[model samples]
Target: MPDCQHGLIADETETDDESIIGDEAHIVARSDDGPRGVSDLTPEDRDKYDNLVLLCRKHHKIVDDQPGFYTVEKLKEIKALHEAWVKESLHLDKEKEKDDLNYASYIDTIAKTFDFDSWDGWTSSLVSHGQPSIRYKKLKELQTIPNFIVSRFWPKRYEELEASIFNLKNVLNDLIKVFYKYADEGAIDKAKETDEDRTIRTRKFYKIDEWNPELYNKLSEKFDYHVSLVEDLALEMTRAANLVIEKIRKYISPKYREEEGKLLMTSGPHMDFSWKTFKVEYKTDEKKENHPYHGLKSFMTERAGRDLHYGEGVDTHYLPKRFEP
Candidate 1:
């Protein structure tokens, strides 16, 4: 198939020929009665790399049409021979190989900083009170990861990883900012009559102390809005982090196992909040007509246009949906 002069793209403007089309022809046909049909393999196993061979379109058709001649064993032997030949004949760039190894190491470092093993345990606090319980030391490490990402040069092949990293950084920064805005620090209260002073230090959302009903409602709504935003950002950050892990697994290490399932972090199956939806509903409510934050809707709408460049070089499809609008 490598010797076959089919599926090559001729570009008059460019000196080099484009990539050749190598169709993934199955050794054992996916379904019975097609090509080298077999009933023993599962649907998942049928599509596995071991059961597949890369061949030119013409050879793919020929092998499928004459399955008797190109049996599973025969195809596998041919594949093995071709691979051996490629290994011997093709000369890989040593510098590029070193770069790839370095890049893989860099990605591993980033993954470690994320601490995927303790992700669920720490992120569980997000939904409980819209604030993460990550230790200050871990928080500092997480904070520097964004800077680490932007300071390095990412390979073009792993653009998906790059985009996912940026999305995660954006969401993480937003969550941290929102947390700082509402997060109350530890405080101490001294009793007038008692000898001992009580130390009251709890991590909770700030509460408004206004007595006026209308003003209180307005402030309360604003506080609720921020809490919702924090939760939403936390969720987005989880998704983005998972996506980074996925891309790392795909492009760098096939054996890499981080999270058990597709989702690395989740706050359980509860009511999922969307800041965008909350903003829309808040704007439509007639009772909150004079809310000061109503004017901020226009600013939120411009997020996509303002931050679209973050996904530049990578497929924007990998970005979180929050950046869409």
Candidate 2:
């Protein structure tokens, strides 16, 4: 977008009568029923219409979407020639760009195009009025209008205030940050509690309760209503700050340690060991000479000692299952 120039110009609704004519310029028809193409026009006419090169919507879209086909240099050249031709034909003086035309009306057109009505269901909207405060005032007025058909068009007006509200919000946030800094630096003192100003003074820490308390209180006494939104906000902020501090101290450290351990176990080597012992006892039911398997135990134990290398006096098992083999 081009930078806008200040001051009011002609209203957008006003139309100029000087027309571009053939031979020198031509209009490209957008559809089968629209204006004809440049090739059909004359080559020598002084008419300003000779300056227009009409393109169908598709071609225009292409030209805008991929400008390399008719590069920026060529586009600028064409625009300059066209504008010059129109200026000469209409005897119009070169004028600075108008802010009302460039910014406000353009914004209005976009808002109307989308048919967005009412702030009730919309998260975001755009406003295009000149003064930020006036736009906001209009938006607030919409809330008072009844929801019947008479006020059905309020959403469009409300949308036009959205940008204004955004701008104002930015201003407010900056002011709040300034006040907080002032409070932190001891540049501004916390207001003391009084019979009537008790809560109002306390809210200085949180809300836009008062920009100038003396003025605010005088107005409030006359109006007979609380204007201590700022003070209430300050109190809430103090509570929130305490909550955040407590949460950080109680939970943040141990949580970090647990996460660190999990990170190490998956990515590093660690050992797990177990310790237990198995004991075996041996017994004979019959005498060795009377039994067929008498020497089997002795033979097996001797073989086991030679092959397995058990410690001396370590009892040996012959029956595999019974002796804990």
Candidate 3:
């Protein structure tokens, strides 16, 4: 097999220099490296993505020198498929890396980010040097290492895992800022309405200003909006945290983490919502059946009404009161 001419597959051959570079093998043929050849590759792509494929000297010449015989499309397709198969077979094995110190440290990178307040932000989307918002920038930094450390490390949940976190961050980031904005400056900018329907629904929740009756009358509908927004933000954020926990559960066995004393984080402030969405009616009905009843088998007490308690058990880790950035 070592004497064979094929670089990828083993075969019977009597060649002395079976795997030697140039004469017996090619990483990517000299001709194919060109734009007009069978394999057009950039430096980074070739270096990082395993864009280069080896071939025996005989096949290398045929692949590179003759574009008609070996097309660029076919080579790219083969290279892509091969890389995928390799990842599917080895790189996605989470159980193999459960006890790996490097990987555990990598997981800590994300877990610790939540511990500190520096990566948090408002949704003003502050930009610097033509870059994305600061929060976006921070989240991006967190994402880049996961794949490099271990490709498809999160397995099937990876897609929604990233998405839910992103959404959760933005939702809370925006709501936190909006809450502060109304506190600092009584009225929101009417022109920058992003979600009018949700805003309308959120309007039924609170009354921040009591002194200015005119402004109160004008924006009374939206007084409780922050409550609804906070509740939704908490719900969405917890859903995201659950996805992360689910992802961790996928690869690492619970017994392993328990044995090793590594805490599998499922409970955090971001994963807890101590608020509720209150449904309010603009007009109070004269009919006692519409109101909440203390005791009776009346239609209002049985089906239409019951006591509403905003959920309890608040955790600040998921939604911190003070954010550094």
Model 1: per-residue lDDT, tens digit, 235-288? 556655766666667777766674364443445434555221111111123212
Residue-by-residue lDDT tens digits, candidate 2, 100-136: 2333443343333222242212211111110011122
For 1-325, candidate 3 gives per-residue lDDT tens digits of 1234444544546864343453332234445545333445554454443445555666666666765645555666666776687688786565446434443454566556543222223211221111112233233344454344344243333343344334434434543444343332212333133422222112232354458776766554343333433433333333334344444545443443333322211211222532222222111231222121211112112222312212223323233346213
Model 3 root-mean-square deviation = 19.9
Best candidate (score: lDDT): 1
lDDT sort, best first: 1, 3, 2
- List runs of model 3 lying over 4 Å from the truth: 1-106, 115-157, 183-214, 252-325
TM-score of each: 0.49, 0.14, 0.30
| Candidate 3 local Cα displacement, residue 60, angstroms | 39
Roughly what TM-score does model 1 have, to 2 decimal places? 0.49
- TM-score of decoy 2: 0.14
RMSD of each: 18.5, 35.5, 19.9
| Candidate numbers, best TM-score first, in rank order | 1, 3, 2
Alpha-carbon deviation at 42 in model 2, angstroms: 27
